[model samples]
Target: MTATTTPLLGQMMDVPLLVSSLIAHAARHHGNAQIVSRRIEGDVHRYTYRECEVRSKQLAQALIALGVEPGERIGTLAWNGYRHLEAYFGVTGFGAVCHTINPRLFPEQIAWIVNHADDRYILFDITFAALVDALAPQCPQVRGWIALCDESHRPAMRTPVLCYETLLAAQNGEFDWPLLDERSASNLCYTSGTTGNPKGALYTHRSAVLHAYGASLPDAMGLSARDAMLPVVPMFHVNAWGLPHAGPLNGTKLVLPGKDLDGKSLYELMEAEGVTCSAGVPTVWLGLLAYMREAGVKFSTLKRTVIGGSACPPAMLRTYEDDYGVQVIHAWGMTEMSPLGTLAKLNWEQAQRPPEAQRALLEKQGRVIFGVDMKIVGDDGRELPWDGVAFGDLYVRGPWIIDRYFRQESGTPLVDGWFPTGDVATIDPDGFLHITDRSKDVIKSGGEWISSIELENIAVAHPAIAEAACIACAHPRWTERPLIVAVKKPGAQVTREELLAFFEGKVVKWWLPDDAVFVDELPHTATGKLQKLKLREQFRHHVLPSALEVGDKCPLEPLDSDKGAASGATANTKSAATRG
Candidate 1:
């Protein structure tokens, strides 16, 4: 018998989760909160949320007056500043898409992205005037250009440009944000185009808002109103790792460092603004640590920092946690994961473990946050157990994960409703994840897969080595072998033999690097990750003469560490570094 029951309607209101609501909430509740930015004009710009909202409305009006329609793409080529943040809200709030352009990309890539998106207007920073001028001719679909500065700062350009201040000043009436569908696209961010041409990630208001909430939880970024937050990450990439939205949501005091992310500038800004928490890549912290060591400086108010883009070296983590009173939160994500997937924070049970034991968990990428589910799949697409030992391809599924890349007729990025993250990782029984390497970057030696990231991490721990990247170089018999491309520390010396021997007992005897070649500098992406593609191409025919001499067995005769062809490390780094 069929049962019949009454379907009662709930009393809750169906309010759309629009980004404009976030700004409006901040304006009403946290109006007095400060938003300080080091402007491109070499001056510090300061304003409150109340003032920011008013200006955003005016900018929204300006955008509308310029013939921007709902769902239109409004591009921005600016750094992390007040104006960029304004464009973020104003463009989306006015029912248009804000495509934050990464100027670091190649000229052709930039032109392709703008023309492909069919951007109506582009707001460029004064520093990028020449770049925009050069690109405008290639992108005929762009209606016009707006300089993100006062009339005085606008450069004499070949194309007609309007000033940001002038445009906002012309609009006097208060503009109301449109009732936008939460599922509609709100922002567009393209990948870095490492393998093929970059593809756009279309983010909707619902996904963006839900992602903000997920990232702000205590288990995640844990931003609070009392905390003075500084996002050193660029605003163009993954919405600056979603810090901008999280800030206003939590009423966290924000400090935006313009373009100069050097040690001196970052240190001064952090101290001046009392930055309690910061986020950036491992390379960024390397520079800051070097500067602090040289200048004998200590962090006054800076307490916690989130390190991502690449794995954080164990030595760097210890320096921030043990040497200085700063907490290093290791995180992992891709531009596709709304940029934040996992954060390495110890749970109560794990925190009670001894420091040595705790380091083991700290070294792995953090566990997945709620609202995000992850599983590792073998080559056959079958799910693997969370046994710490078996590393497999990582796949994730969630509300925010991309269903399909923008404008691609190519099949969806998901396999059976799960997004394959192109990462080789191991998940422990406790849900901790360790990202071994990118699928393309993993070295396939013989029949086994060797993690390049793991090898590089072990190599950089050597005191004489400043920076390192591991790439799969072609070999005679093994098909392929691991080659470490290294940068020597200043005033230090170490031979290839010594560098290879340094890996003794730290990894499997067979897993040791076949060769160590020193280079002046390693190529890096704009987001601070090692560009292994370039290294692979550069060393495609690299011959491991030294390792070949030893045959299939380990080499005998470890060279002394004090002597080498190049420079660095006046002192023994073995003791100074975190010895595995």
Candidate 2:
């Protein structure tokens, strides 16, 4: 009566899901769908899916002619444009790994990544031509360089470089894509490496294809052939959040903004191209919003935008949805998760809630997508409840999620078969994830835990504050307390006490930040997330007024009832997780 180990199989033809097939399907079904790009040449270029397919085939043939073997790593330092799109399909179509390098990283870091990835050839845009020349000496393993421009437009470089158009012209666009295993690696992306050296995430054809499907669901990005999609996210970042594959899979018109990602350029392109939906980080959207406010203009065709890479401030979300009539899709994920975990799309029941209630729910990171499974575990490694009160470390597992980092000889970083996301969060009964803070960023004072994200969100809600970041600082009596570092809007001024007073009723008194400081701007990672490590180091020796009063000569332990000092350890043990 036990379940059988083997079962009868159905009569169905099996085919491997590969990256090449997505572009082929688009070319065959929706041949005329346009792919628009504002090229670095200070002009816009347009092409169709059929043309893109032919050129992509040409690129594959060219790379192969240059002796690029399957499974080899090929790098790209380009923007989101037609040529970059061609590389996405071309390099992967022939079974080569497409490693997109972020040009914004330090030259040394870029060289280190290139050397670490063992990239055979780097296809770079003209904007990065000087960068390639500067780092070419450091990347000794790189075999060749190709400028992503025609023979006439190629820049003079210290190293020998090939012209992209000349290479394509030699090919007849008749190469056939090889039918490879679906598990073959198609893409490579490295973490920002803020703490140390960068680690890579190798994505397979099966994972990429499945992620495209999962990301295009109605509750996800809700992509379709009718929508004009503009991904403000770079091609180097998590495959632009999987838009390159998903866009062609659905035959959606892609509007690439190239190197001109400033507010004016992006707004003009979106309006000119009649963009319907977009996706990017919060910082990009903030610039666009600022431009719109200054110009007194609104989106004519833009509808919704997916904001990820970091938490979207409540104030920014409200402005996008209320003032501009655009739906803000708040999303959260890590590069290791194929970067798509949870997206805030309300269901019918949740939508029926009052405006205030619904807005509060939207602030959470939303429910997990179909491909992902999530849970919160306390310091003891026990799963926490979904009562929305208890917070713990977040863990996730899925087919698309990485089991091990590329080239990593160390043992797997998973815990009991789950990948720890290093985030402290709480989940509601309906399965919404409310991230409290990163495990390393949370502040512990008087035996109580404080969420820096919550504090920053409240700080940014003040009109005078343009951006804010809360970091844990040393305290004599409390061990560590929250301190706010903020940037004021242009021509806007507010005193430290006024900023501190703004958070009075938003959060509990115990959770309020000890002090607020103003700065010209804040440090950010290449991917647009706050660099708290640098902030913590800068303010490590900053003395608080309260600490000065107490005198740091000798530390004194507070009574049990003084400020819940005795319960801090127990509270952390039960609800918070300590990340290794």
Candidate 3:
């Protein structure tokens, strides 16, 4: 028997075709929709969808005039601003892959990424001018640099730089968008690479457009024209969780937070723009929450917040939902998954339940979105039950999911068409996923694994703590133990005993932090996940007492100035005795 060809379910959409055509569609359909940008200069920039389209077309023409080749990469080191958004569509709309380089990464990492992506032209925001200058010497592949600034904020650099407006001025407003293959690469983002060197995930035009569509669904992000969206997540990260495209497609009001992500600035922008929806990692929300409590500021107009790039603590969910009236939507994904695999939007059945019940359900990352499939596998490579109790490595596959890493690296970890997301998770009977920890982050003590994320979340719930990270520390008896590194809230003092008490009854006694160390700040990855590796390195030499070594007195004590002085003299005396 002959195999029959399958019929396509949706319309074909290439990068230029989808982004440019959507611009035209939004201009024709939702021309009155607004785009608000808060600049670093403390000025608010405003434009309508129609005006944005006009500018985007002008930018596309300008990019063409700058000699941007059809498939060449155009990099942008920008914040979440109108100019960055313009570059997003303008570059991809003209068939060039928009490589958004994360400025937060180390200068060397940034240079490596630019060189790896082979970006021909770099469009940088004013705030990253110094960063660009630092990385310019290392990135030989970057042939041209354009500063995304107007006349007032022209970047000052020793190298000959092209002004964004000047380039636009040189070209006509009209340019033809090439009709390219749907599977052609469009956008590129690198993983935070907590485990290894950052790897690029090249997204195809087809994948990006599909991701935008999936992300806009009511069951996904539930975005619409009626909503005003402020993407607190940087544009350099996972296409800002695909909000830039989904916002325009849904005709939602776009609010760009620019370079100011501090609590006061973000709160003011959200309030002024009447932002109904926003998206960011938990760290950003933590700052916003602290600001609200300290300043008595409230988000009266905000309704929903998409929190991801790290686990959203239950306290954050409750504070936002019950106290502030903003629904905290937990989302989960990696750079390889088009950065959006699941969203925590409650279904109609769950939404009708009590708020407490709904919040409990929302705490777990919600069901897989349409076109996405998820499963869990145990150590023996057997599929685990979705009973919520069985924990295993989570694997996912979807239309928009990446099949392989860019540049064809060996050991790409794609198995049977599914990408093994390094995250260890449990899927409940209701199909919600709860991430326990990353495969490498889970601490195995005495042969039993412990979830570092669970410990960290519980520790941070302590009122005096601002943030927390738990890492596996070397143990003489147990073979491995947990060390909690925490940053205390400003003006708040917390002792190790106080924090350990907070974990009482919340987790297993064995899982309690063996030692709690206070730091000014917890190290975070570019995507905002806790950098436990750094924490481990910081406290690796901490000596713990064994059963025989333990006496009545505790081995650990606060380091006092007097003790240091005594020890300093002892060291000198010992040196003199050795010389004699």
Q: Count clashing residue pairs per candidate.
A: 5, 1, 0
Report the number of the highest-lDDT candidate.
2
lDDT of 2 by residue, 230-268 (tens): 999999999999999999999999999999888999999
Any idea what lDDT model 3 has? 0.81
Task: Give the residue spans of candidate 2 off by over 4 A.
Answer: 1-4, 553-580
Ranking under lDDT, best-scoring first? 2, 1, 3
Q: Candidate 3: where is the Cα deviation over 4 Å? A: 1-17, 351-356, 409-411, 545-580
Query: Residue 554 of model 1: what lDDT?
Result: 33
Candidates 1 and 2 compared: the better one by TM-score is 2
**Against the correct fold, how does model 1 do in TM-score?**
0.93
Give, for candidate 1, the lowest lDDT window spanning 10 residues.
557-566
Give TM per candidate.
0.93, 0.95, 0.91
